[model samples]
Target: MNAPTATLHLLPEVNQREVPAALIEALKARFGDQCSTAQAVREQHGRDESSFEVPPPAAVVFAESTTDVADAVRLASQYDTPVIPFGAGSSLEGHLLAVQGGISLDVSRMNQVLSINADDLTVTVQPGITRKQLNEEIKATGLFFPIDPGADASIGGMTATRASGTNAVRYGTMRENVLALEVVTASGDVIRTGTRAKKSSAGYDLTRLMVGSEGTLGVITEITVRLYPLPEAVSAAICSFPSIEAAVRTTIQTIQLGVPIARVELIDHNTVRMVNAYAKLGLREEPLLLMEFHGSPTSVKEQAETVQEIASEFGGNAFEWASTPEERTRLWTARHNAYFAAVQSRPGCKAISTDTCVPISRLADCLLDSVAETDASGIPYFLVGHVGDGNFHFGYLINPEDPKERETAEALNQKLVMRALKLEGTCTGEHGVGLHKMGFLVDETGAGAVDMMRTIKRALDPKNILNPGKIFAL
Candidate 1:
């Protein structure tokens, strides 16, 4: 496959103009200079980090408050134009692509830390607040947000995607972290769900429902998320194994024995080589596990020792520990950049990242099968993942224009999804199905179940005005 020379996603027919003269005049009347149809500006909010490329929205509206969002939504609803919420533009699955092309509701201007209740151990923030900015603000409050997506992605985007990271095993995913949200419905009605309380037998559990809705349901304006006290002691370690099987086996044993893992990331040998070649890191080209322990000093030490013992049982070696703040940050930073390094490693090849989650009991088998399937396909790809949580990523390098490579990658990904579903798992663990994995999701969850989801989507967004052509087009 030849790499695409450029991506050309034109605007939908009804929205060829970035912003109609009437809409622009109305926007100026409502909030002067806050709305613009400037091509250069709209291009900024047009797409996310995913592979799907589209033309810039008709206009980019810099929303400064929830009321502003409501007003924009109401106006757009009147015009019956597609409205796509824009956050940090870091979505790996193209969650923010404006395919129908109405207006990009850029939320960065709405960034505000609403409240930080230390007693409640929760923080309320506007959608524009990035994960890193929120954590920095809460650093002095003795509490910090634990949902780290590594991209400084907006809190709203994180919640919408139900993103998880290296620390998911200990802190949980966005599903568990987001306690409540103030959402703008498609009809421009503002509503709130859940509470700051730790426990609730609340009706419907709408907070959880919207956590991974991917903006097809509603636009999140404000978010309330559970926070944790900064760990008393933080320790990160790197464990090396001679083979991928050994590393996976050690991870399986550690989990089976109930080790409280903060992070148990797997970097296959090929990925390690890629990182070294692309990022210039002095890492051994062997399958390695990047592990972290977070707790009291004694608890951290105990967890480390027990995990190391399990690793040794599976031929683990060079158990290097990084405890200092600098060391831990450096290790995780390098690990987070592993995706970019992998992409850079192969020149002229675009990355096709696939994710799957399996039950812990079947993790080893699933991972082993993945290696075999990749080899059988004869396509070289990089594999790394947050294995502690049974979620892994297969980043396949493919020529964007080559049909054969695309077919091979798709086949391997579909085969992997089938195996995962057979083991009673999900097709996507964190990354949402923006334009990809639509069929895999149906196969995993059954067509009837998918139909029910569509029914709900229609009920909430009858016009399909909210991010059309996303999450299975209506």
Candidate 2:
């Protein structure tokens, strides 16, 4: 119950580890123009969306194929140097930061959709491809990928983090949708797990293991993800509530009664106001729910009617529909930009994002307490959630130069995570344990389980060269 004994200390000074001169020469000879030690490029790969202080890699290797990744890893392994995988560089938990200073395997150039088996409803892609690009490529196939993490993040990054968004309520998270993976182990051995088959009973569930490993065990070079048929009819709507509690209750009931809602998101009053100002939309600034329904026309109507009845019981207003594709895109775009809107509202402030997910039954309690605590803390914050799956985030906007605000935000985040663990839920529903949740991982899973994880890490990567010092301090 007390605050976790561990605490984040001062942002330690970046200790740039020295790369062996021989290794650098070898890399230069092997990669030629593809290898770079340019200060700008290293700095770019050093940080992600997280507010962690930048700790740049010694060099960046723009890999164009799985062979390139394997060779880089093999070379790094030879020298016991850390290798951090880089995709779109949008990771929220400092997953890309060169914490120990090594080589960054930038796979962005590997972007490609290798094959789309329309008959099997599966698509195999190089890890560097982004979700938006994948959807655009396969749009004409009448099949779409459902896992939307709000970021145009690379599929490899999404798999690493086990990301999910609003649509997870009905479709599922990366844990469920990612069918298989081609991983290059720390030893530079290429291996494939799972098949296109709908089910398998072979050996270990290695695919699932790599899906959320956060690149600790191996590098995901290729991914085969399940796809779904585009809905015949789709509708998006926004409903405002007089209070946050009302909005959460509506979501709880809608899910409990099995309304089959495709997506349901909760944006608190402050976030709604920020989005309104940023997106130039005219609407009541109150706690709001953005929902979408996908099915046959009659089924969509029925689901809408059921959800409306549930909403009315909780004082939800009539829905404002975005019936057309363009309208839907615009509305979702604004929702996706909620983080930027919150940050922009605070001018020069940076955001410390908190990802907490609790059981559906306790969603209201967790959120109410969180909102009240942040409100009393006097720190500016915005709230949004994929409430359908009991997952939400609080973007605590603060001037990075102010230590007091930073401390306050971290304290609040710790409390939120502890609360979620108490409710028999996870500290993070989608966001994997990058640098930020290392302590929470120990607290939530206990020392013994984490020890087993370390055992697996050692068995797979004895040198601890793959994304070292990430999920836990080894």
Candidate 3:
């Protein structure tokens, strides 16, 4: 398949669209101290963790409340300008690109834990509050938010990306934890969806809709998330496998046996090498499984023993446990930075990461095939995943200036997506289409379902201005 000559369009959030000086002054006057047009600030908002770089917004509006976000949206709409909500800008898929930049609705200023209903095991937080911050604030309440995207990313950004990490195998993704949201629509309408109750047969389930909308449907100003009680016991370990096939096969067996594994991550030999070099860890360069056990002491012991038994059958080594909190934190921290490790392997190279998930039964075949396909090139790459959930990522290293390397990476990604679809998986496990996966979305979901999505998008954002040129363009 030939790739399109899309020219890597420039949508710099700072200069993508013209914002009148008068409009800037007006916003500053109305919000007073909340609006900033400084060059550094604009430049910061212009870029994201995504490989693509675009223009920054004309001015950054540091929203302090839902009313503040609504006001900013109203002003942006009045000028017929595009508005992009800015969280931590950790979006790996260009979800926060200010394609038609106008005003970046920066939500970091609204970092506040509005309420924590421990009785209901729910917490309402301003969109700017990050998962790390929320957990810190709720630490004493005996309840914790378990959707760990690995990064200390803002909850709003996590929700926008429908992020999930190693913990996703046990705790689920943003799709399961986010109970409700307060969204500010394109028309500046404030709407609430979902309730504190555990379950709701409520009309429409709109909250769930926006949770993974990737900032296309609306700008989430507030979020209510379900929380879980801290387990009575927890343990983490790094286990080495003889080969990638053995590691993946053992994971499938564990899942098939219903071991209730909290987290099961696969790190291929290539990734293990990258992590060792990047994090300065001394370990044998082999396929590794980073496992975590969470439950009562007896339950955790039983779970670990069950995993050990399966691993032994696959020629696995004994678990090298990280007993201390610091050890566990450092281990997971390195895992979360896997992409960075891959990118750093080749200086000045950008990382192109793809997420593909397959059925547990086919996980071994899927991973082995994908790993082989990637290894055939011998390109500097890393393979890491939440294997227990059948989701994995291939972080491809590319020199953006070298057209061959870049295009080859894209082609490789497309092929990986194809293989995942063949195995009854999705083009994306957590990351939404944003712009990177638009073509793949069509391939995975077909043109008919894509059409229905476009229709709904048109109905909600009739002007096609909410997030122009994203998901689909008709």
* lDDT of the candidates, in the order given: 0.82, 0.89, 0.82
Estimate candidate 3's RMSD in Å. 2.7
TM-score of 1: 0.93
Residue-level lDDT of model 3, residues 1-474, one tens digit each, is 223323332222333557677778789998987888899989898777777767777888898889998888877777777777888888777777777777778898788999999998999999999988999999999998988766688999888878888788888999999998999988889999998888888689898889888777889998999899988888888889999999999899999888888888888888778878998887668898998899988998898888988899999995787756888877675577677777888899888888899998989878888888888876678888888999998888878787777777887887788888888898789877777777776667777887898887778766555666566665
lDDT of 1: 0.82
Q: Rank the candidates by lDDT, best first.
A: 2, 1, 3
Q: If ranked by TM-score, best first, what sequence of candidates would result?
A: 2, 3, 1
Q: Which sections of candidate 2 miss by over 4 Å?
A: 1-3, 8-16
lDDT comparison, 2 vs 3, better candidate:
2
Off by over 4 Å in 3: 1-22
Error of 3 at 92 (Å): 0.6
Clash pairs for candidate 1? 1-402, 2-401, 2-402, 18-58
Clashing pairs in 2: none
CA displacement after TM-score superposition, residue 301 of candidate 1 (Å): 1.5
Report the C-alpha lDDT of model 2 over 1-474, residue by residue, as the tens digit: 334747753243355566777777878898999999999999999988888886689999999999999999999989888899999999888888888889999999988999999999999999999999999999999999999989899999999999998799999999999898999999999999999999999999999889899999999999999999999999888898899999999999999988899999998889988988888887679898999999999999888888888888999995788879998987786588798889899998888888999989999989999999999999999999999999999999988999999999998998888888888778788878888888788778877898999999999999988998888877
